[model samples]
Target: MGVKIGLTGGIGSGKSTVAGFWQEAGAALIDTDAIARQLSGPDGAAMAAIAAEFGSTMLTPDGALNRSAMRELAFSDATAKQRLEAILHPMIGARARCQAEAAQAAGMQWIVFDVPLLVESGHWRERVDRVLVLDCSEQTQMARVSARPGWTSSSAASVLAAQASRAQRRACADAVIYNDGLDLAALREHVLTLCAQWRRCK
Candidate 1:
């Protein structure tokens, strides 16, 4: 394959924005979060299983996974979180692998797997050439998430608690982008510079 990169970072870490920059630079991006959203949609492949596992109350009137209710349940109940992960992670991984294969077959020199849980997954490390983490302080995480619609400081903390710590993510990263105070232009410039280097080296 080409330069397969496992892109990950905590919630509110501007990971999505950075992923967009990479995509704009010609990298084929497979985002697990987007896949998860599709799988949890009303007509999603995983909806029936989710409803069966968590009962119908965990679903919305439209038969989709009730994300807010499910999130609350997952945080308050560890077993629920594990069960959800069990149902979703394998499906996400399989889909990602297929997409990566297709991208490589299309002659894409860069394939970026944007996984929010790359470090926690434990299986992605060997599959990728590098792990790129979008780094930011926990405080910044809280602030950024709270700024989003329907999110509060408490919910942000819960999300941060669920993911790997900053140090742990950094420990596993081959590269890190500190996005705490960087503006969009600077961030884009930084990303393009890295893309240039990687392309030349590739």
Candidate 2:
């Protein structure tokens, strides 16, 4: 119902920061990741299915999905990952679309769906009016991710390798923000400029 833009980037590429800027500018953001977090939190809507499928050991003491265990399982076992996705992806998509419809009903002009795997997700390409990619070198991504708490070079590399390549992401983008060395102010400026240009979100 509005100019629904899909904002995306790889890990540590400042995707969340850009989402924040859009939200601060009054765009209704349907953040899939945040919705996933909610679905995995204690007694969440998907928890029952997860426990039923993956066994109760996949849940923590607080009845939340044991992320570390699930992550390990997903990587080592492809079918495990597929099973998990089968449970969560539909839930996330449904919630996101519902929120989006609500945002449109509220007379909002811009609707941003912040999806990290927009390029990899087949259904997302047609769901939005535009796709925005936050472009950065893989080396920059590795360095930024490795600097985070409890992260190491090997782990960062693993995470990067698992995602869709930068080339694939760039190929799918309608616009690209090359975010290598820009400061926060410059980045904010870039987002705002795009917002102004794309502000015709009727």
Candidate 3:
């Protein structure tokens, strides 16, 4: 694909905001999380594999994946998380690549892969030309996450613990957008500038 950019961030860092700007600037965007959820749904290719691996506990009454139960299992056991990733990540990556290729074939100048787990999945590092991180402090992340109804501070902390640390994510970035306190207009302007640079690279 032409100039594939990997966009990622820790929880609540506003990576979606930046991705929106890239979309506005004409870059094709593929959100891996959305694709992953699809792949983990009923009739998904990974369904059989997941069922075989985790057995009936991972299945819902309607015969689909029990996402809530699976989420808890994955978080509680490191091996469960690894097993889930093994079944889902490769499929997600392949789907993302296919979309990017389609965009390139259509003559798009850039493709942005919004992969939240890019830093955690070392295998994905080689798939993109650049990594754009939307940076925010852990405290900010916790606050934003906890403020959501039904989420406790500890629950938010568990989600944060599952991802790569802030320092690790920062180290992987080719460009970083500090998103701790900026307003939407400022964020939009920053993303516009970044997109301009990306287009120039083409």
Count of clashing residue pairs in every prediction: 0, 0, 0
Best by TM-score: 1
Model 3 quality (TM-score): 0.92
Query: Cα lDDT of all candidates, in order?
Result: 0.90, 0.90, 0.88
Candidate 2: 10-residue stretch with minimal lDDT: 193-202
Root-mean-square deviation (CA) per prediction: 1.0, 1.6, 1.6
Off by over 4 Å in 1: none
What lDDT, from 0 to 1, does candidate 2 have? 0.90
lDDT tens readout by residue for model 2, 1-202: 6789999999989999999999988899999999998998999999999999999989999999998788677668779977888999999999999999999999988899999988877899899999999989999999999999877887788778878999999999988999999999999999999888877543
lDDT of 2 at 162: 78
Report the lDDT of model 2 for residue 65: 92
Worst 10 residues of 1 by lDDT: 193-202
Could you estimate the TM-score for every candidate?
Answer: 0.97, 0.94, 0.92
